[model samples]
Target: MNKNIITLEYRISKLLRYGVMLAGALMFVGWMSMLDFTQNPLLAFHDYREVTFVHSIGYAWRDKVWGLLTAYAGLILLISLPLSRVLMTAILFWRQKERLLSGIAFFVFAALIISFSLGIEL
Candidate 1:
């Protein structure tokens, strides 16, 4: 394998691993806090209801709800991991001068961004 490809793969693996770890940690804290307050996470779920993560984040910020904010931030990061991977792959393909692959990656990235922005479930 090419050195560049190996390096890219290593970087991507690290990104995924760390991203998941961080998200899990954030969720753990969030759930712990919820449990502390309501004595049950599920029972308190409705207290932080929102139409979307974006809205939840805004509400959390305004209300200074640390638990809700951490949870939503983690969710947003988790949800965006695939998009980040696609973007990184696109950049790699571009650097490697693989125009077709790069273009396809870019197209997929754009599609994901559009669907995510429009709140389209797939």
Candidate 2:
């Protein structure tokens, strides 16, 4: 095979892999948010009364914490999401390097999933 052909093959393979990763990340987020967190407002009371994490935060700090979480969650998704795709494209040029992009994508994906599942809309 020619040198140019091999390079093209590697670039294509890298792009395909990156696309798969990004799709997986998005699907994972969507799956997590499929719950009925918003279907009942009473669930908030339950969370406050029952969930240990919610109880630990306490009602006083709930709004503030929720605000921060919402802001960051939206920001992360808006930023990391497009960045993930762009970085994957960049990976082609960078030669299949998935370290940094994968980590950022994972974090952003998790944040998006949690925020969506908890009915935190922005």
The Cα local distance difference test for each model comes to 0.83, 0.53
lDDT of 1 by residue, 1-122 (tens): 69979988898989999999998888888766656644554675567633665576677789888987777678778988889999999999999899999999999999998988788422
Task: Output the TM-score of candidate 1.
Answer: 0.82
Worst 10 residues of 1 by lDDT: 33-42
> Could you tell me which residue pairs clash in candidate 2?
none
**1-122, model 2: which lDDT tens digit per residue?**
55864777687677667655665665555445434566773565575444443453464265554543443344445445454554444554445455676566566656655765676322
lDDT of 2: 0.53
Candidate number of the best lDDT: 1
What TM-score, over all chains together, does every model reach?
Answer: 0.82, 0.31
